[model samples]
Target: MTSKTTTRGEPAGPSMTYSAIQQPAAMSDAGNVLMNWREWKTLFDCYIIAAGKEKASSREKCALFLHVIGKAGREIFEELDLDDKAKTDYDELVLRFTMHCDPARNVNFERHLFFEIYQGAENLILTQMIRGIKGSYMRERLLAISKLELDDAVSWCRAEEGP
Candidate 1:
């Protein structure tokens, strides 16, 4: 018997169809660049996967990414310090955009701020203890230990008070 196939809406044969992938919205807010980039990048990634372009060549993927990012994104891409080879690399392009979107944090300054807050809390505890102590001698002792280690100050208070 001869093989037969039926088509629901079209002739029975191998066929392929592609729907237009929606472009992600262009980033607009300067203050929210990092947040906007993160959102836009997510949408673009979904677009790539939905369009069956995950296996596309690096150059082609890079081109598609650049195209979908809109005018401002293109400008930012142009400003990125990419070498010739990197220009054709999708991962390199993504890295450059990520760096551009998210600025490097000042680790030293952050550490200093953290220590300042921690020291402030310790000083507050010492000040509160000095105010609440019954004797002037105890208050003086607490004040002296304020400039020393917090653990030392606590141990001094505990030792002077007894069990």
Candidate 2:
């Protein structure tokens, strides 16, 4: 079943906002919170909703996104004008930022390369496992074998063995 929502039409969950994430204090507390890529991602969605810009036009959403980020994120992006031709979907903006800033974006593939048990020296993907050890060259070679190529080879062998 679907969950309930607030009278404001937001979820029953509390909405995230600049003030919520960045608490105000005395006048001396004058600095924007420079959110990391992860925090910005999480708050970005919520900010869009809370501001009632979830269904707003792409141009509006783009402007709101940039505004939600405010001064702290100005440095992260050099050029973002809502009137620009490239100003399209808000998701596109999110993608561009992720590509530029997400540090752990390739961590999973790197982890898999280091940790997957070598199937065999004859293994099509990990084709150079030498004697009971895996050298850097072998690991490098294994990384070179894209998952699509391995999948195609597996499919070919399976087809040859027939149903």
Stretches off by above 4 angstroms in model 2 are: 1-35, 79-83, 103-163
Worst window of 10 by summed lDDT in candidate 1:
8-17
Q: Candidate 1 — what's its lDDT?
A: 0.80
Output the number of the lDDT-best candidate: 1
Clashing pairs in 2: none
Candidate 2 has an lDDT of 0.54
TM-score per candidate, chains pooled: 0.60, 0.41
Candidate 1 residue spans exceeding 4 A from truth: 1-18, 111-163
lDDT of each: 0.80, 0.54
TM-score of 2: 0.41
Query: Per-residue alpha-carbon lDDT of model 2 for 39-152, expressed as tens digits?
Result: 666767766665566789887877766665656455555643433465567677777766656445478787566555645323534232222233455444445557635454
Minimum summed lDDT over a 10-residue window in model 2 is located at 23-32
Best by TM-score: 1
Q: Write the per-residue lDDT of candidate 1 for residues 89-122, one digit (tens) a residue.
A: 9999999999999989899898667767876877
